[model samples]
Target: MIRTPASRRHGFSLVELMVSVVIGLLALLFALRMVGGAEQTRRSALGGSDEMQNGMVALFSLGNDARSAGYGLNDPIIAGCNTQFSDTKGYQLAPATRGTTDVTPLAPVVIEAHGANPDRVTFYAGTSIGGTPTLRLTSDAAAGATQFDVDRIVYGFNQGDVLVVAPEQPGGDCLLVQRSDSDPTATRVTVAADAGMRFNGGTPTATFKGYAARVFDLGPVGSLAFRSWSVADGYLQLQATGPDDASAQPSTVAEDIVSIKAQYGFDTRTGSAFQPQNGLQVNQWSAAMIDADGSGTAGDAADWQHIAAVRLAVVARSKAVERPAAGAACTTTTAQPVVFADAAPVGVAAVPTTVNVAVTGDPVDWRCYRYRAFETVVTLRNAGWRPNP
Candidate 1:
């Protein structure tokens, strides 16, 4: 309120005050932007990392098991992986089984007798769960139906079943399963629980398991997806369902999965390419070869047993961890075609698709980064493993 000449002169000039205010605002905006960018980078990195790790776990883990696909269960080891279990209609022969006094690993075979008829020899996988299946002979599925299950005896696999973390429920439970006799002790079990079974009252003679199992083929020319070992003729099969409360399908957590891509592998050196028993030529490289058909003729193809390497890829999509635009919608389509050649003579016309969604998941929080890409090589190593046939 003073009107003294000295007081008036001391007051700040209009331009000086305006400049100071502008400077302060500019600093505040710059700090905010830096903080925001750092957060975004972290989120992106996190999403990528999560997907990469998941993919590695899937490929490497399976590769480790497949390397042992067929070991000590075939003649000349690698060569016998393609041997047929049986050609009879009455019943399929046993898979991996305890070797008889007369049987030797050199001539690994499961002989089944139809009473007076001579015993039939079949190749299979044998696994060890509660107790190690030293030498398991391949046996048929349930008496009435043709479905693989944890039973006293199996028809296709011997002791070579795979044991690893499940694709759907990794690190959840543990189990002992069976694959083909030719398979090593690699892809049989499907448990992440502590090794060994629980003998509460008494451990069930068998346990449920699914390892390195995948949608092998979608029939010769149908959209119907089948497991690697599915054979309409042999009839013994397993079905994989979508997310569910029960075990068959778990991990409904959307963001948990980033991306999944699969291709068939074959014996390239064979000239004929790696073809399964059913006579389907495989095109891509693979860590392990499936029987193709329940006919159980993996080891039979010397080329397959000789395979050396495989090609694998995994890509996952997570929600933007901190998308400035939260309510943003993502565009997804099933038409995103994945064309996989039919291996040889006849190829699939239309490209089969995996999945597509429009924002069902969200990105992770900022701070940590998630690697996005995962690529690897799986070499065969086991009692009787081969990558180049």
Candidate 2:
């Protein structure tokens, strides 16, 4: 097939070769565009998924804790100022549950005064009350046993678990002690040297069947938990103060949580005739009376016991930014659509309470990203079981 250069047949015209090259380039550009679009779509989907997962986890944790609030305490709800040992609400019998402001614990009345409000909820509970007792003393109660012979340890009762020994029969005395020896063998537990001998104003003289003991694990050893949730730097954080520790350090629970709002459900329906169709009503603390002294106020502790449920709402944003189509109605001025009143009306006898956190500092163009909202009404099981005071 050899031929002379001139006879090699003129390859093709320069213009024709240029046209072929241009077509090939166009096909390659089209394929590149498709790949880029697919990648962007994948990223958006993954971002939205992450946002949803975070929201669910946050809600679950908050709700679970709320249900167990005020467990094993004498009273389900205790007034912030009430120092009455009998009426104190918590496992340790202090003012167990308090809805305080970011600065100080506020009565329901002054919660909405601040423009951006975050609540610090502090409470404690025993390991279990309704279910089968996990840790019960195997020895009888007389004056005191050097070490506790527990029936079983469900989760490996660690050292420092607050132990409360209560008598099976009413009127018998109990004891509150902190476990000292670190033994996960589920048999014997050593008690602290300074453990209280008289529980509930009496000493234990009954046998193992006569008295039972339960442990309260407050995260760290030898401390009651003072757990709180707040938003900082666009992340929802959970913090706790050990019984021994005064301050709490927050750990991020979820990212991109912009705001949190809550409302309390009070069991206001008293007597069948006066009761509304719904047994629950929102409590704004407007009707609650305040007593500077920690005395037994009429409406303060009285109203706290009526708290039956809590409605919580939170808003989260996708981690990745998204671009909307041109001319799309994608614009949001504020973090949320609802209007948050910065100032309450003067002399307002009863303003509807709206427990919410307002995020300030940097405004986010919420329209540029995907958003998810999580809301649930959590029933306080312990509170519900208690009758209205």
User: Which residue pairs of candidate 2 clash?
Assistant: none
Total backbone clashes of model 2?
A: 0
The root-mean-square deviation over C-alpha atoms between each candidate and the true structure, in angstroms, is 16.8, 11.1
Per-model TM against the reference? 0.39, 0.55
Query: What is candidate 2's lDDT per residue for 1-389, written digit by digit as tens?
Result: 96668834788778889999999999999999999899888888898898898878877877777776655442322222233111012222322223231111112211122223544333444443243133656666446554666666635455555555544332233445556667666576676454431122223343334235333332323244435666766688765434432332567888877665555555554445222223444433221223312333433444454555555556676777676567665543234433222222223123233433334564544566666767766665654443332
The regions of model 1 sitting more than 4 angstroms off are 1-4, 7-10, 13-15, 48-51, 71-125, 128-255, 268-310, 317-371, 379-389
Indicate the residue-level lDDT of 148 in model 1.
Answer: 38
Query: By summed lDDT, which 10 consecutive residues of candidate 1 come out lowest?
Result: 215-224
| lDDT (Cα, tens digit) per residue for candidate 1, span 1-389 | 85778846778888889999999999999998999898877766775665555546644533443444334322222233211211111122223222111111112222222221111222223223222222221232221111232323322333323321111221121222223233333332222222221111112222223332211100111111111211111111222111112123222322333333333344343434433332333334332234433233442333334333333333333334433355643322213323122332244232232322112233433212222334443333332332222
What is the lDDT, from 0 to 100, of the residue 146 in candidate 1?
A: 18
The local lDDT score (0 to 100) that residue 317 gets in candidate 2 is 67
Off by over 4 Å in 2: 1-10, 74-225, 242-247, 270-299, 324-364, 387-389
Residue 45, candidate 2: C-alpha displacement in angstroms: 0.3
